[model samples]
Structures are given as structure tokens and as C-alpha cells.
Target: MFLAATTAGDRVRANPGGQAFCPSCMADLIPKCGEIKVWHWAHRTDDCDPWSEPESQWHIDWKTRFGLQNCEVVMGPHRADVVARDGLVIELQHSHISPEEIAERQRFYRRMIWVVDAGEFREHVDLRLASIRTDPYRQQPTTYRSFRWRWPRPTHARFTSPLFWDFGDGTMLNVRKIHPETPCGGWGYLWTKPQFVRRFAVHVDELGDALEDGATA
Candidate 1:
């Protein structure tokens, strides 16, 4: 994780010898500000959130976009990747996940979505223009495209939450739905980075309100 809680309950980024605790379990955290990997905090023992994978630069970049307070949010016994002001949990997935684990997270968060790092599979995935129609999400004329993976990941078939695929580009593929056909394919809406963030995250001006609500709650 990039941030840990101070004794005063304030969220802070990792610093050398920074004494902090895990927001989810109150466990002592070791500040890992190495020159090699991404600077982050690690629990002295084990991670409180079993769903958490090792943070990569990809994860850090996305979390940075959402801001520290909004990322790594504690909800009950688990720490969410990103929780919007409207109570939407956004899970950033980069590593391989089991179908059963995906279902478990959906059940835990209840109201959640996924922003998957699909760069690794981008080369194997094919996109075709399906139609040129008015996109209800963007409220504009958009080019709808259908995506098909040469060899689809089994986990993709079990996804129940809304999913957006990020391919290291400045745009996102908002998957409308997965196709049931033999060669797995789906039609989706395309969104720019700014558009998706604006539509999902709380406005910068309202971040104070979000923080206050979290503090008070």
C-alpha cells in the first residue's frame, strides 16, 4: 500500500522509518522506501486484506489519480482500492484472479466496479467496430467496438461487476457485456481517462466533503 495511518489517524504516504499502522487491521507497518520497487508500506506480519495484491507502478498511478484519502479505504474488515464519495468501490486489478475470489469480493463490496489492467493481454485481444450509435453513458455519438480475446481468461467469464479495461492508453473500454458466443467477445463504450474519472470520482471541490463524511462516520 502507498499510504498508512499515523497514530493520530491521519493517512500519510510512506517515508523512511515512518511509524504507521494499517488502516484495516491496526497492524504496525514497515515503510519500504527502497530504490528498486515502488515506494510503499508493508505490514510487519501479513496483509489484513487478503484480496490485496502486490502494488505495481500501474496500481500506484491509478491510486494517485484518485488521491490518497479516497484510495485504500477501509470498509468493515477490508480495504477497498478506491471508494467514491457516492459509496462506489472501484477495484484495480492487475494480477490473475480466481473466479471464486472475484465472486467473494463482489459479495463483500456489494456495490463495486473493476478497472482492470489489460495491457498484458492487449496484444492478444482484437477489437472490431460494431456500430456507430449514441452512447447512453457519454450521451454522444460514439463508435461502439466489439472485443474478442484469442484465448480468454476464465476469470473474465465470471465477472459480475461493471468492468473497464485499461490498456496503458489514455482511454478506457467500458465493457457493456460479455458475449456468450464461442469466441468470447463483447461490445463496449470507449471513454477517455478524464471523462471516466470525472464521471466516477467526486469533483475536486467536493473532496473535502467526502473526507469530512468519512471522518465523522
Candidate 2:
């Protein structure tokens, strides 16, 4: 968890020797400022959200891009990775997840999407050019690609929400449609990093403004 609540109800990042509480469970959190991993708050026991995973730089980067205010939001008994201003929950998943867990989260957070780190599974998946068409509304060319999942994990076929697979490149494969029969495959668009971020993050406009300010003074 990147953000914790101080006694004064202010959200703060974990620092060395900092004392805070989990915003979701209100459990005492210990600040972990180690060198190997991204600094974050941890619960003494594994009593908090059962679905919570170890923090990773990939998770941190995506959360930071969405801004801390909108990240680590409490929804029911679980803390969503990133909840956009428009009430969309963007779950950043890097570690392996079970199909049951995926279905559970989908049921819990009805209005949610997934941004998965494809580094782990992209190797088992092959993509090839399918077709390209221009959108009449946006007047932008849309490229479509077909994917073949060789020996795919069961979880790959269990996505109820939108799954954006990040291949560590600047582009993401947004699975627009899926064919769940044996030897699962799908067709989706390759969205650039900015396109994905801009569509989901409304506060990105504020970030853009801050970057556009000519004066660093």
C-alpha cells in the first residue's frame, strides 16, 4: 500500500520509522523503506485484505501515474489498486492470479478494469496482424491484431472486465473480444501508453497542466 492514514486523517506515503494505519482495514501499518523494493506500508499479520499482494514497482508506477489520491481506494473490504475519478477501478496485476480470484474481484467491483503485466504470460501468447480500419467517429485508424494463447492459464479465459495486457512496451493489447473455445484467442487494438492513460485517468489533465507550466519557479 503506497498511502496510509495518519492519526490526523491525512493520507501520507510510507517513510522510515513512520507510523500509520491502513485506510481500508484501519490496522496498524509498519513502514517498509527497504532498498530492494518500493517503500510501502505493511500489516503485521496477514489479516488484512486476503487479496492483497506484495507491492511491486510495476504496481507503484501505475498507481503513481493515476495519482496517490485516487489509488489504493477502499471498496467494500478490499483496496482497489486505482479508482479513477469517474468511478472506474483499474486493478494493476503483476503476479499470477487464479481464475476464481479473478471472478471474485469482478463480482466485488462491478465497474472495474484490469491492467495486467504481460511480462509473465506474453511469452506463451503470440500476436499477428489481423486488420486495420478507420473509426468513423474519432477519425483515427484502428489496428486490430489476433492473439493465440498457447497453453494459456485458466485465468486468461475468466476476464469479465476489460483486460489491458502490457507487454512492457509503450503499447497495450486491449482485449476487445475473446473467443473462449479451446486454444483461446482474441482480437484487440494496440493502444499506446498515453491513449490508455488518458482514457481512464481524468486527473491526467491536471498533470498535463503542471507539466506545461513554463516556469519551474
Using TM-score as the measure, the top candidate is 1
Query: Lowest-lDDT window of 10 residues in candidate 1?
Result: 208-217
Local distance difference test scores for all models:
0.81, 0.80
Give the best candidate by lDDT. 1
Compose the digit string of candidate 2's lDDT tens values, residues 1-217: 8889989988899999999999888889999999998998998888488888888988887787777788888888899998885898998898889988999999999999999999777887789876786633225776778888877666766897988899876667887767777778888877766666766785876666323323221
lDDT of 2 at 77: 89
Error of 2 at 36 (Å): 1.9
What lDDT score is found at residue 136 in candidate 1? 88
**Pairs with steric clashes in candidate 1:** none
TM-score, per-candidate, Cα-based: 0.89, 0.87
